[model samples]
Target: MTMVNLSFVLFLLCGVLINVQIARSDECITGSIRKLYEELNCIPEHDETNGCITSYNCSFTNDQRADKCYYQGREFSDGDRLEHNDFRSKCIPTCSCLVRDGRAEFNCAHYDCAEFFQPPLKKNCMRTYSHDSCCAVGVYCKKENEEETAATCEYGGKVYTEGATFFPNEEPCKKCICKPGFSGSLESPWCEEVFCEIEIHHAESIRDNCAPVYFGDNSCCPINFHCAHASSDETQETEVESTTITQKANDNTPTCKFGNSTVEIGRKVRGPEECTECSCKVPPLIECVVNSECQEGKLKTAN
Candidate 1:
């Protein structure tokens, strides 16, 4: 009830009110800065030294382009969106798909070949080496032996080897032919040895019917003549009926069959004249003067 007691109580009350006001002001400033950051896509920087004891904020301006980004009342030095072309865009012909629309734009520091080199949404018209970095065209692989001891011969993996396998099986069936003393050569006709062989069939048929190699990521690979790459994915479709690589011989010689056609291993046949039955004629002598080559021993002795 005394004056001094009342004055003391009043001072304490004033101090408490001031402290409450300062706390409310700090909270309001922090909430406001956070809201601003969200709206402007700016980073928030906390600095309590400059009257910002509770919380602080910062934003990027025209003066600083690369040093800062603001978010949630905090400033970050580095922040970015998804890298553009750095990711390879893989596209397919038969199915509907979704991908980023615009070209992925980014500095080399942020985007590189590993992440964006194989995006699934890139231009499909561009010639691609491989769909998912697996196979290449004209990949020659040597046929595996029956013993399964042979390594797979890849087409362009440093060493080049043409793959061949027998059509029916890995090796020819052994016939029950008993030989006396076995004096003949191991590969002779009487020896009944296993030989690598291939059936004479259309070779040109595959030239046009061969389908493009589909990559694992659903991109079409460029075709190369001898051994083009192919998709091993189960979802991918193959144009031919089980285009399997069977075992066959390595001979390129064309065989003449009694049927309507004859085929050589590598040569292309236009018609029946190239068959075995076709007669080969020796052209007339252009500079021959031998007496025996004439009608008689000495051209009838000059008649």
Candidate 2:
């Protein structure tokens, strides 16, 4: 073969090889690229300027597929649910993960106060004005009633007229009655010592026979109070039970139930009498060391 003819054949071979390479890499590469974007289309097309031809991948990556959400160091996907106490909310307790715009988001439903005021969780139901976002924010049953009046308790976005009662799940250890307020008005729920009694039958006899316990998550009533059986291991079990109760009292939540409400360790509560102050040095135990309460006349004078 002649030298020129061989050179022409070599050039043709080079052109074919170049075309094959271009065809193989015509599509865009994944991850960050430095090519200038012009005709950014999903379909592959040839570009004379730069090889940055294919449209950028507009899909989710492998690590984050199936739509998930991370919140407070927790991962939640579609249909996953969170308890009411799982995360603090000023309104509702339970939160659900829902798909919104193809992403997971936390959604909380409106709580109903009247619905929870049943036999098991609570009885003698009275609406909670504190520690309950549903009652504080929405108030009653989360619906506008045409018959709602000014003398009604707002809860769960609805209205509870006078004499209507609800058992707030936030602080289920308190007892409430559907009766009128202490001063003969519904302005404020009676909030004095022994003001309300949770329907728990924890009498002196029951206390000796069985240990006081809580069955439900926040239910104050314990019909059985059955944490252990009666046997010769009573003393050892009692000591162990006392330790457990002490541990529970110090377990990052409320430890002791007072006349009106529950208190935590190191917390200040009411003292021996009115206008007196005390501290919860131990779980369910109060120590009155600080006595700086001004007399009623002094308070009136200051006012």
Candidate 3:
């Protein structure tokens, strides 16, 4: 290849390496400006005094280096309006990603909305709830609209007929009654929680280690029962563990003095008295069993 072509290739390679070295995720506070380099194919803006700082200004394909904003796993430019909600996803709709102090940060407007245990009734106006914003009233009652009251309730994106009782799909356990207001009435749709009463069966509860637990239909609370036994494998494992512990205890057992001799555990000592075989089963206590040792070696031969 020609030396001029080789030099030009080397220069492009050096520029690419310099750009790659500055595509750092840590430059942004929330590590969002890295997407401009990694995903959006952007180059770091290098100044003669400050080198490369891509958190605020990154040159994109648009042929301009502009400040960027990031919010909710997305990148946006300045003056970009962000559509988001609060944690409940039903309130505090005003959220935006904007350049506040030389850096992009998310700015949200938090409102302390009054909460009602039951659905509230708005005066004169036909009330509508919004899942997008916390705005409860969608339409207002004007003086010309004297008889524009709706007899149906609008909730969760669906209009329900008046006096309709239904279970909410989001929460199957809660039952809501839709009582939309007329032109003169003032009641709105409301929901109530149904709790099951528990009854204890004293006689059957203590019958065994395990008892039946029951649950009510479409209810979060169980019918309120207790007790479950270990599985057969679990019981066997517990038994084996107990046996191993017992064996270990016996292996480390102390000795006991039987008359003239200091005997270890499980050692059968023919007692000084007749027909009694005394053995040290536990430390400091010698258990004596009167039995077939009295018949001499006949007991061993029979076994």
Candidate 4:
């Protein structure tokens, strides 16, 4: 061959080799994994000689495909070995992150000092200690008089000691008690607000201008009506006496108005309007007392 033709052929061969090298390099990039590590800013030094990337600060074992990587920062992946550093021992009892089904789960189970200690081969008691004979490494231990094993209750995102009494911070009227159980279980202790009813009756004479009022527990009766007994003698006189009743404005008690007259709580009013007897009692409740004999007599006379 001519020297010039040979030179051109050699140049074409070199270009083919360069393209092949570029394609091979692209295959090694593993774009998805590289992007993930880049986003986390955790990609480590490349070990070109061994064809591996070393995240020196983290210890991980690669699966067959190296698709999932587990590390000990704030999370773990499935198949991760539970190690001493995975635990947070800064508070009474120790807590650790457990990976299950590719999700991070938390648990608090460490109890004794010995459990916090590493094995002899890996023994390094840098942060492990005993406080009151409890695990005290990398975390605080229960105080001398502290009850470390008490089961706690959680409600509305707040934790409470078992048997604690409190009203929900968001609902002052909802008095609740905490008992040991699952945090969100239906059987968990809860707050209960008790309610009562109030009713007011108006007299026959005032019935046209006045009406009965009803109220629930911790509520105030209407202010318009006075309760008094009618004269039983031949005079048939009606007497009305006014009494002042006041309740806290912030009590959030519900009220109901029946007519023009405001019902007075904890009072009695005679009513010939409907031949009914009524009385207002504590808790702002009102009810009619049935006169069975009178009712029976009326029925008998009618028959």
Q: What digit string (tens of lDDT, one per residue) describes model 2 on residues 1-303?
A: 999999999999999978866764543332111111111111333333444332223122224433565444466778888775664343455667777677555566766755366454233333434433335222343244455332544544554555444554444433233333233332335321121111111222122223233232233333233222234332211122232212232244434333334445445443334443343323232323322345555678889
Model 4 misplaced stretches (Cα beyond 4 Å): 1-147, 169-174, 186-259, 262-303
| C-alpha RMSD for every candidate | 37.5, 29.7, 30.5, 33.6
* Model 3 worst lDDT window (10 residues): 197-206
lDDT of 2: 0.38
lDDT of 4 by residue, 179-272 (tens): 4554554322354441111110111212222323322212222223333333322212232235312222333432211233334433445544
lDDT of each: 0.25, 0.38, 0.39, 0.36
Estimated TM-score per prediction?
0.13, 0.24, 0.20, 0.19
Model 3, residue 226: what's the lDDT? 31
Ranking by lDDT: 3, 2, 4, 1
| Candidate 2 positional error at 105, Å | 55
Give the per-residue lDDT digits (tens) of candidate 3, residues 1-303: 999999999999999866765553222212111222322233433322334331222223233222454432356665666554323234445655466555444456655654443365456434444323344434444346465344565766676644444556544434455554523222233665432211111212222212122221222323222322323222101112231111223444455333324445445444434554344433222334434445566666679
- Error (Å) of candidate 4 at residue 224 is 16
Range of the 10 consecutive residues with the lowest summed lDDT in candidate 2: 32-41
The order by descending TM-score is 2, 3, 4, 1
